[model samples]
Target: MSGYSGTDCQIPSVPSSFAPGHGEGLEDKGCGNGTWTSVEQLVAVPVRPFTFTEAPQTITAGGQYGVLEYHGSISKPHHPGEAEFYLLRGVLTENEAAQLLATCSQALSEAIGSGKGRDLDVDGRPRFAVEVAELGVLDGKGSALRPLVETVLLPLVRQKYGQTAALSSACFRRFVPEERRFIPPHQEYDSFAVMTIALQESASYTGGFFLQGSGKAFVDRKFLQLGRGDLCIFQYDLCHGVDVQEGSHLELVLHFKDSPQAVADGSCPWYSKMVEVGDPDGLFGHALSLVKKDFPAAKEFVEKACEQDHVEALYTAAEWFWDSPFGLEESQNSSASVELWRRAAELGHCRSRSRLGSLLMQGVPGRLQQDIWEGKRLLRLAFEQDDPDAAFHLGQALLQDGDRDGVTKLLAACAKGHPRACFQVAELYREGQFQFPKDLRQSVRYTKWAAHQGDAQALSNLGHLLINGMGVVKDEAKAVRLFRHAAKLGAAEGMLNYGLALLRGSGGVKVDYQEALEWAQKSAALGHSLAHQQCLGGSFRD
Candidate 1:
């Protein structure tokens, strides 16, 4: 249940020994030389195969050269993982990223098509303008992509790095023109790295050169450009980027970090049981990101959340577990989620109490043991807590138990503002069972209330009352309207009634055979017996 917290910092460069094959010869230019310690010392170690149960943090710090520092703990440390970053202050979430990318790509394409900003680079390539926004998460399309990144990518990085690592907040910004001049030699210093996968192809724009850094000379360096989904990983300290030139701006940044945790023995319980099962691919990182996005106390809880906040925490944990195939046995079928609900119910969490009561009532085959009396008791508890659904259920239970007074009292309480309860009262009245008087006026009132709540069944019932003149004065026009509304809401009986109304032109309504046929067809599709017979020219319709 460990959470994450961090602060952004700016560090001056400290000269350090050049790691081989990390562009050793090139002069350290942009940010001064700094012998930054291993990424392990900087960030909190994580439990391997992490499944984030909460949201991410939102820290605001801006500068050409600065570090966003985060502090958080994982259940176990030795496992490997990867982290994704996004610039929250500038634009929010993936929707914004898609919009910005689409706009910039389109503009760059138009400029190239119009023969503007199409000058050739030093390599005689057409130049195009591009915009680059760094610090963006690749999977911001929605909650759907979180599973993919958390389950698939982080484990892969961990495997390659041999240990878990911390993710940096900085994303890259590279605006490359179609011209060759924009390509610049670069290298990084982190032990392992990965780049964001772009949704669109690079060829759609002009003057985007991805140059691989040559440890050789600074001025005359060799480089290579990349296409979407292509990744480049090397020693942590390689310099890379596009040489500034006119073209569409592109964001190209690499995530850098060192192994954060010490590797554990394969058989350790915490490592094997919790860390492995809990975070199979470090999904917890993404979960943190989501928690940050949705909840207000994301940063605080991520940094210090415990199991006591189990209601929200367990729900998030359940979601993460449900999304991944790894650790299915331990995480997916969590007793924690059920226990959390039970605890909340005990604490008078109305929704949780209602849900627990409903679950008790269901007696899920092979999961929940059957106990109708217990279910009724729970439902009654929830009903007393003012849960509308619980009240409705309690009424049904009491009615079945031959407790007419109890049923009437509970139903009345829910019926005041709850449509389902109102419908239930109408149903009891219509049946004339349990010694309840079949008052047409009361039936119509309750049914009307349910219909107003958009209950299709109630609307159909109201239509029947109006058509038969059972409650209020007969009004075929009103009946037809009710029927049509119910039919639109997918009420099969309503379709049949509306069709019949159209066919007969009853109650001052117009006759339309075509419309009647359509409604009849729909009703038949929904298994309305009379409508089906009518459509098939059987005896029922006549």
Candidate 2:
């Protein structure tokens, strides 16, 4: 290969001995083979020094090579955000670039093959964003790239971002013309800064450009071009995206977050910090680690983690926000949940897509903006993925829109043993809501299926059907057992029903006023109105 060169960038050439085939044992892994293999032996580290210089004159408008909008601290003053910009110019030895590219490609292929990688399209194309630690195969000596990060990249980051910034995450990103993946503009959080290192030969690809701006509106944007071994560093929260007009693009992205000081030992094998900090997944794991140490509030941890390019965290955090699991305020939770779900959905989390669809279908006056068309599109995407929950929710949404096939979708979910879906099917049979006529047998059957799966309401309702022989053979003893099971699971109505049955000697059980009173009192404590009334009236076995 010819010596590396770039516009306005000077890089030294490597000796011919370091070329692809010049070294012994280097022939084990062939280059450009298009097949990824495990790293059996550690390859010798290339001795190439990377260097760069800042431009003397900065231009404002187009035709300028590089300009910075923000630099110093990454976050906004007083508030919690920051941005920084740096341009690095260097060229890797041909052999080093080839080895690094091969390592990343193999890691990506393995992740995709093992189902750890996210699918961008229904055709099973992999998403550009990949969490390196999530692959589970590459760790410590297991990864050929660990030495590169620890020995080479670590000190560089510390020199640039200062020693206070902790290593947050590293990801492998690949863009192919066939996939035609265009990342929409988005901002990062948790990370103080992000560094992008080019691995592929830039001249080989056409029409791939990187853009970053201060605001979501691309009013003022800076486009950066990086050659092989070149890198760029910028604030994590800066609005950024990639536009691929043609060929393939590949890069390695490393992020840093402002964190408590730790020993900055470059030779200490920094990748091991991933395991020690419980951030092996490198999705929300970094923020989750902070939450574990009480370094940040749970809500803040989730908020920051969700903002990073972690799609799985976006989905899980959306659910957490909607469910108010970590004590987030309700109004904020609902809005944040929907927004996060939308972001995750856009990034192609099928489940998140379905959830956003459900939320959009609601068309709630203020909480979630309505977009029926978009909602249906997302729901269909999820439904095609065989997600039972998505099928159940989409079926309901379609039914509300007067699509009769929604019933079929619900039944499909029920067939998959989705407990809530089974309950929905049972309700449809019980009420004969759509075209189907009322069928007590079908209702009882589906309800039983749900109850067996620990659906609390199903247990109570099915117990009633059993006691009254509403749709099946009467089995008072079994009814009592079901009610008791439900009550223990914190079903308030189940508690009241069990108390009443025991008090009246119903369900073929011997009457026990003491047991009945105790159950009634517990139900009353749980705010069951009927149970409260019975307890207030001191009426057991009345």
Residue 394 shift from truth in candidate 2, angstroms: 2.0
**In model 2, where is the ten-residue run with the lowest total lDDT?**
1-10
Q: Compared with the true structure, what per-residue lDDT tens digits does model 2 show for residues 1-542?
A: 00001011111222344333554322233423322111112121111212224333342312223433223222222113445566555524456657778877787767754535554422222354566532212353226556555555555566666775656657777766323234534445445567787887667654344443322212233345667766677754455555443467887777665543332221112223643554423334455445434523544545655655456567767777676544646524677777788887776666687778877776877567788888888888777644556777787776666555576677656644556677777776666555344678877777877765566667877788878788788898888887888788777777878888888887788889999888888878976777888788878745
lDDT of 2: 0.58
Q: Provide the lowest-lDDT 10-residue window in model 1.
A: 1-10
Against the reference, the lDDT scores of all candidates come to: 0.45, 0.58
TM-score, every prediction: 0.39, 0.42
Against the true structure, candidate 1 has what lDDT? 0.45
The true-structure Cα RMSD of candidate 2 reads 22.8
Clashes of each: 69, 5
**lDDT, residue 524, model 2:** 81
